[model samples]
Target: MLSSLALLSVVLPSALAATTYDMVKEYSGSTFFNDWNFYGQFDNLTNGDAIFVTSSVASSSKLAYVDSTTNRAIIKVDNTSTVAFNDKRNTVRISSKDEFDIGSVWIADMYHVPFGCSVWPAFWSQAPNWPSGGEIDTFEHWNLELHNQMTLHTEPGCTQASPVQTATVVNSTDCSFQDNSNAGCGVMDSTDSSYGAKFAAAQGGVFVTEMAESGISVWFFPRSSVPASLSSNASSFSTADLGTPTANWPTAGCAIDTYFKAQNLIFDITLCGDAAGAASVFQQTCSGVCYTDYVVGNGSVYDNAYFDVASVRVYSVTGMNTIVRVSSALGFRAGCWVWGAAALSGAVVLFAL
Candidate 1:
């Protein structure tokens, strides 16, 4: 009885703490498109250069489909149809059927992204209620520009000053919408190789976004530089184990939990409206031609306008187990994993019986 009572003291607390991450959800494979809700019609990005942009998106069209060759979801902007002076170009905008809350990790594996003149492609997530719910842009680029940008847009009073990563450029540390730059609290890759043609030349890569108590982090892993743990093809993994991220937005001066909440994942393509055509944008890519004219008239230029995605895996924070070390008289402490308190108590009672 004495020995058993001593064991109970140590084992009870440890059992309640030993936990592990479980794969709560997975959206993988070509058929994965079936699980997503496609937004046909026009793009919802009504601000910026996109205000002038319209959509010819259709539900059963090639603008969004599953490719047979690579078994990846192929989302594209239409360059196949005839375009007039004022016609909306064909494009695709889709989103996940599900929504994710805070403290989740999102992994998107892609093969190609729609790129080039007057084009804008983005993979992002946003909550239902504007800036109050927070926004995360995992992939965004425009025109002939050769860099990838990851931005976070949130309500007022949120500013991040996390340690900068190697070669990462911080465009703004404040995510509030009041900033004139609209750069948001974001970061950009130093080299052009991480986006557009150069990124395609290297066969695409993985973009991972992890949202936890520490704030938000975005990491880009070129196909050649992917980690072994992620390459193993598991349904879920801990973001804490991913080491240093390419972009880290720690909640040092702000409470990220207060500003951000459930968000719907979205993928969209728009042409010559906000960012590309704005008077302030780097519009030199169009040369003497008008941005809209080139985008609408030059139908053949968008032949390669598309996003090829292999899969998007989502993981919840419940995966991280709380490890409480316990040393019994027998000194059994090495890798002895148990469970919650209620389960352990019941087991001890049965053992006594």
Candidate 2:
């Protein structure tokens, strides 16, 4: 005779085993540009009035470079040339050459992030096809906003049904690309130091994201509070050690495996486009028309529009096989449980008999 408790344990997967990560890629210092692909002259998908330059232009203009003194990587918007009205400001948008699937974790150690009127910057991941492939925004903000907004965008049929246990407030529960004018499901970190001027004042920090079949989670650590085990040279890390994340998307609400797919890491800074260019969103934190007042200026207003990155590390999962699908919420309710492999493949059949 099999006990119900024993049966349940055998049928479930262990969250701890699944979350352990081993470092696989590190983008840092002089070699940062080697692994990235410039988008090159493409129209801003967000409708922002910025010109994304090619790798040669970026290198020639010093728009993207490794600081010799600090050994840090810098990616910035052009602040030297005055642009005529209706013309686009030159900027940079780059994506990782390698893509990562589920059971992956990314940690970005940033010393500074872009901020200014009409400036929209983001550190995110996306599938090549988009909408259908899915998008995960690890860190994003526009204008002079004070907090980071993390979001997920996917094709129709995903929703945030389970409440997240984190330090963020949910802005929307729907993750569909068609709803909310394609806003997707978003949550805002509940801290002033998570973005904008304040974050820069504190010398920036780390943003960590975990993507798994069960769900996705994001955490922000101020430079002063970052764990010692996390750094540019870190070889491995355990997500279980990171306390409650800033935002969590559990599987109970959305099928993460179905909506999200292999994703390439990306970073970009654009001016007065898309979300930042919208009159309604722009008026809240900035003044003047988004295009006229900011896009045509001598570029002095964008002195702060840059990223000073210590490193970006990608870790792949280890020790756990993701052959079986499990509900993340079940682990939450059951208090950190794991099922044996034999049970996962054979126990269900025995229980049914």
Candidate 3:
């Protein structure tokens, strides 16, 4: 039998009024809605228009879905490959083929970025003309160790110097390949042992960048650590404890406030060489084959190629007024304090009467 999951909802107090929103749930058992629009060069779609299966390595994977439950929508990408050349041999390249846009806000969450001699996984956003509308790369990993980078590709006038933040692992000797430039991008080193065990292990989590009135706030939640409040309330997380700010952020050059406006959500995966203009960047990550054959014999090395989306919700805060009134006992105490002597005599007489 097909199952139906209840949509998640978030409620806030009147004093801290904010907007509330929710994303319509889609699962193995559900009907596809018309609000969704799919864009890319691939096939093998599934799961209520939420999942797309494709075989093209050098194709783009851009799919959008509307959350009927919240009037908002999300654009997603799945695993797709790109084309690149190693000296003379042509190779299908695989980087994180996922990118999306919401109104003016854009986002991309990357995983298994190509490395070694040649590999690049990028999760970036762009506007109309290359860098004209403004490009905000949530995370980008190039050929390096222990370092992750965050860059803003914009007009020449833009002055924000791209800052690269590095992650510090107590035991770096164990997983050295996992380390990279730690710009604003968060990191989980290979020394951790269980770094790339599976999808739930390697890239099992949520990287959210919200563009709201409060400004742009980026959050990274491991699969196990995501808060229910974020899943329920979606909109107002001002009071959430996201920890202290990082040092040397890209605040001086690029004003996040001006560039980040309200945006929709996107979830996608693609291969290298998919994005039209960014072919050179894609070439850097492509290997001999676009995708590696993990299906060895009867067993499979790609055991963790699944995205288990428990739910997606949105929220809008509601306003309410609270009233305070003086208690009866307090009123009587004031009268006694004001009419002491005269009231005492009158009280005795009245009591006797």
The CA lDDT of each predicted structure is 0.61, 0.74, 0.28
Q: After superposition, how far is residue 298 of candidate 2 from its true place, in Å?
A: 0.9
Which of 1 and 3 is ahead in TM-score?
Answer: 1
Which candidate number maximizes lDDT?
A: 2
Task: Give one digit per residue, the lDDT tens place, for model 1 in 135-224.
Answer: 888888777767777778777887766443543445556677655234466566555666788888888988888766667778888888
Model 2 ranges off by over 4 Å = 1-18, 319-353
Question: Please, what are the lDDT tens digits per residue for candidate 3 over residues 1-353?
Answer: 00111111111212211333232222211222221222322312111111233323212332233345543322333323232222111112111212222312221222333332122233333332332344444443332222333333333333423322222211111111112211111222222211123323454444444333333334455555556755443434442433321211244444555544222222333222222013232233333333232111211211222223333333222231111121222111000000011121121100000
Kindly give the number of clashing pairs for every candidate.
8, 1, 48
Backbone clash tally (model 3): 48
Question: What are the runs in model 3 whose C-alpha is more than 4 Å off?
Answer: 1-35, 42-125, 128-130, 139-151, 159-199, 212-215, 231-235, 245-251, 257-264, 272-306, 312-353
Q: Model 1 lDDT vs. the true structure?
A: 0.61
lDDT of 2: 0.74
* Candidate 2: residue 167 Cα off by (Å): 2.6
Off by over 4 Å in 1: 1-21, 47-59, 290-292, 319-353
